[model samples]
Target: MITSEVIWLTGASTGIGRSLAIKLASCGNTVIASARNQQALEQLAAEYNNIIPLAFDVTRQDSIELMQQQLSNYSGHLDRVIVNAGTCEYLDIDTPDWDMMRRVMTVNYFGAINTVAAAIPLLEASPRPHMIAIVSLATLAPFPRAEAYGSSKAAMQYFFDSLRIDLVSKNIDVTVINPGFVKTPLTDKNNFSMPFLMSSEQAAERMVKAIAARPRQFDFPRRLKWLLKVLGFIRALWNKIIAS
Candidate 1:
């Protein structure tokens, strides 16, 4: 029932990005799916002829430039760009891999910037271009060991929020999507409990619905969002809970 459009989706090889690619393609969209794993992207594209696999690492300039060339040659325009490429690394204060901060920021924050840089010209060519990125609810409330991951998403949220203002003149809409816990390869690595964890399919369905609305921001699962909001409002209570 969704209208067909051209969409470029990052992190298409796994997790929520992969799920979103499938859902979008099923809805009749032509999806350019990107990821580090060429084989996985190829397999995903095989399942859906509408999908075109473009393999590259988000953190590397050379990789991003190569994909930019591919985009230029493949299509003159992109109706939407979905940046779901990111990595999460928890910080262990006691024995922290200080470099993990750099690694996470490089992909989650700077990587998204690189994607937008490549896609902006294409987006401008479309009649109604939309930019979307998958951020995390972790930014709403500080969680133990999430120093690195949460900060990256927080940066992403602000970047796009500001970018939305600048792109309005170009008629390009920017949407920042904040999702709570979802079962995926990335969250599978989490050692702590993830409240209200939902299936990636469910998350994708919600996202697609929100995308149709073209909201400037979309936060899923109202209950979890409220819970985080409440925690964020009470620093003392949040501090005590996480300290234990």
Candidate 2:
């Protein structure tokens, strides 16, 4: 029942963001999809009249501000802003590339912050403003070669948590979605095992439902969340279990 909501979403070229755009549009919300790939965004917008294509690179602060201005031209307020644009790159300890870490952090952390900054004014104009970020379950536990990716997501988790408290009195809800492996472009590149991997559509559905509840944190797949929680408590034991 997300009727009449003017929703702005980033990273909508593919993966979870694209799936979410479709789902939100189908649910009767006015969805503005943003991504660097204009063709992909246009294709998505073609699928539904409610979907508006907005092309911009989230990593660029000026790009985000321009996007906000464009959005303002179309709609006066944004009920929800989903900063789902993120990049994941595993760190190779052998190579120890600081540039790789910087690349990931710039897109996953700084990109999200920039989007939030740009959208805050539009969100404030809404009667019930909500901000959602698609973080990662990797933050819940340490995983090999995920040094950069995990750390970036962890930073996003903390940022959103702090934002939630600060925006509480303003009646602007902030939610962090910690998804386990989902069958998206991001996970498709992973060579390692991704247990309990769900389809992007399934993930989107879960996100839509969870967002309706307006929970501060939405960790999907109960089994996976429980497993991660238990493993987080005893890292050594979990390492042994995974190793064996």
Candidate 3:
């Protein structure tokens, strides 16, 4: 269990982020919950004394600098920063809205960069600083209608891996989380069936315990990872089946 540390978590207004905030706070950790939804964050804060709501919009101009300033109001040093804010949109193969790609990239790719930029300064102050981001299992292999989301998360996986090297001298560790699928309001909108669909609370619980060792990368649950690997190995057959 991760305890007694100040954790700055984005996307905390809902889904896995919300569950993570509750779990972390309950373990006697100070959780800085950030999201654009102020009312939702406020409600979460009211329920957990260890939570502090800091509503933020990643697409705003100079967001990194602004976020750093806003975060300083909560704590001086951050032991961990969970870059979880994300958005998804499925493309219509017949008439894809090209603009939707930009929206997802802005939030998932550049937004992650901005978040890391803002957190690094504060993280440097901590004796044991760690950075974690929620990338996706889609990066393991291509998926239909996931061009934008998958590409963005794939970019994040690369970014974090590269950043891990850069931050080595600074004594900060980076961990990337690739979750298969979790039940959330967002995923509820999905038209396709999700394999090994875990609950947000369950995912959150596992994540907290897993990140304690600060491994370079982690993927779950074991069954989904296994399935993705098996599917990747048989890409030719999988492609023929998925082409419909």
RMSD of each: 1.0, 1.3, 1.0
Predicted structure 1: lDDT = 0.91
Per-residue alpha-carbon lDDT of model 3 for 51-81, expressed as tens digits? Answer: 9999888666477787898788888999999
The residue-level lDDT of candidate 3 at 65 comes to 86
lDDT of each: 0.91, 0.91, 0.92
* Residues 3-91 of candidate 1: C-alpha lDDT, one tens digit per residue: 68999999999889999999999999999999989999999999999999988688887666667779978788999999999999888
Worst 10 residues of 1 by lDDT: 60-69
lDDT of 1 at 185: 95
Candidate 3, superposed: residue stretches over 4 Å from native: none
lDDT of candidate 1 at residue 207, scale 0 to 100 = 95
RMSD of 2: 1.3
